[model samples]
Target: MQKIMLTGATGLLGRTLYKTLVKDFEVVGTGFNRATPPLYQLDLGNQQAVIDFLEQHQPDALIHAAAERKPDVCENEPEQTIALNVAASEFLAKQCAQRDIALIFISTDYVFDGKTPPYLESAQANPLNLYGQSKQRAEQAVLAHSTRHSIIRVPVLYGDVSELAESAVSVIATQISATQTTAHDNWAVRYPTHVEDIAFTLRDLLKRPENLGGIFHISDNQAMSKYDMACIMADILGYPQSLLEPLDEPSQSAARPHDCALADSRLKQLGIAHGREFKEALKSILLTA
Candidate 1:
């Protein structure tokens, strides 16, 4: 079996990716501040520490899953955001290039301006916020470093969460549970994909290394805004929908795209896809949470 080194193993998406990838690959999981047993501690922001870890494991491929995904937080702390999201990525790409290790960098659909719908893999990136800008810069760095490197862009994701507030998707339930009067942004659209589907898609993609280069978009087709998600959660939790309000205009500290529907053109050609109905899946996750 091929060895794969995964970063951010203790995180939301990282945890799922680790569980999925380990079934077929010799997976080496790594984490930072929350590092625990079975998860090697390594700080991506520290270049030398990262270098040493890479040298120690020397996996066949590495998945850069650790990132600052919060737009508001990234806006508040640009230096910290860029250090982990951009600088660390560039450094990792360089190191991977030197070691001849295949790299799969997890990215976000926010790389686009959201003015355009259904962005293709070849689409030009014009980010609207610091978070998107950092990921976009990191994408450029990774691709520029080597042709063997791959970028997988996904949209809002939700899956088995440790807490209601852990995932942006599941956080709707937390908000609705706290107060039926919670307000949500109705302007910006999102596609809440299950993280397990992304993990499965990646697992399948790993079987064909020849198809692992350039950019690929992985997302569920169902589109809904925060308000839509909250309303659904309210219904799921038996809360009154009347109290939930929708803000028609931008309601976030950082500007977001209106709709960034990713066109899974590359993944489509490779005959690889995984998706599930929004409401049905949400019901199971919410019931468990």
Candidate 2:
């Protein structure tokens, strides 16, 4: 079996990918915090530590999901965000290139400034916020360091989580379950892709490393506002949809992309079909919860 090193194993997407990939690959997982038996604690901000970890493990491929993802926090702490998102990614890409290892960099839809409806893999990135700029720079670094790399850009994602706050989708479920007043963004639209779909897609991509390289946008084709998502969660979980308060384009310290939905026809063209629609995945998560 080929070996894989997965960073950010404690995160929503990282944890999901780690679990699914372990079924077929010898997975070495790491997280900054909440390190368990298999997942080691590694400070990705420290360049030498990341290099040392890669040298020691020597995995055939590295899936980098670690990043400072909070838009507000990233705007406030540009230095720290750059340290983790851009600098760390550059270091990883360089090391992977040296060893001829496959590198899969998890990116975000924020790279596009929401001006375009459906961004293709070939679309030029024009980030509006610090978080998007950081991720965009990191994507460029990966491309510069190696040709054998996959930069997968995803939109809002949620899946089965031990805690509701772990993801945006689950957070809505938690709020409605408690019958608490929740605010939803009605203006800003996003593609709510499940983490399971991303995990399955990543697994399929890794299986054909030779055929997969360069940038790819992977997300469900459906576009819905946050208010719409809240309503769906409320309808599915038997909670009153009235509990969700619709806000029209609320102000944010960090500028948000209005419509950052991604197009995943590239994955379809590559013969990898992802399972579960948004409604189906949301129902599964809430019902099981």
Q: How close is every model to the real structure, measured as TM-score?
A: 0.98, 0.94
Of the candidates shown, which would achieve the greatest lDDT relative to the real structure?
Answer: 1
Q: Write the per-residue lDDT of candidate 1 for residues 102-177, one digit (tens) a residue.
A: 8999999999999879899999999999999999999999999889999999999999999978899998887775
The 10 consecutive residues of candidate 1 with the worst lDDT sum are 173-182
Off by over 4 Å in 1: 177-180
- In TM-score terms, candidate 2 sits at 0.94
Which lDDT values do the candidates have, in the order given?
A: 0.92, 0.87
Q: What stretches of model 2 exceed 4 Å from their correct place?
A: 177-182
Q: What is the model-wide C-alpha lDDT for candidate 1?
A: 0.92
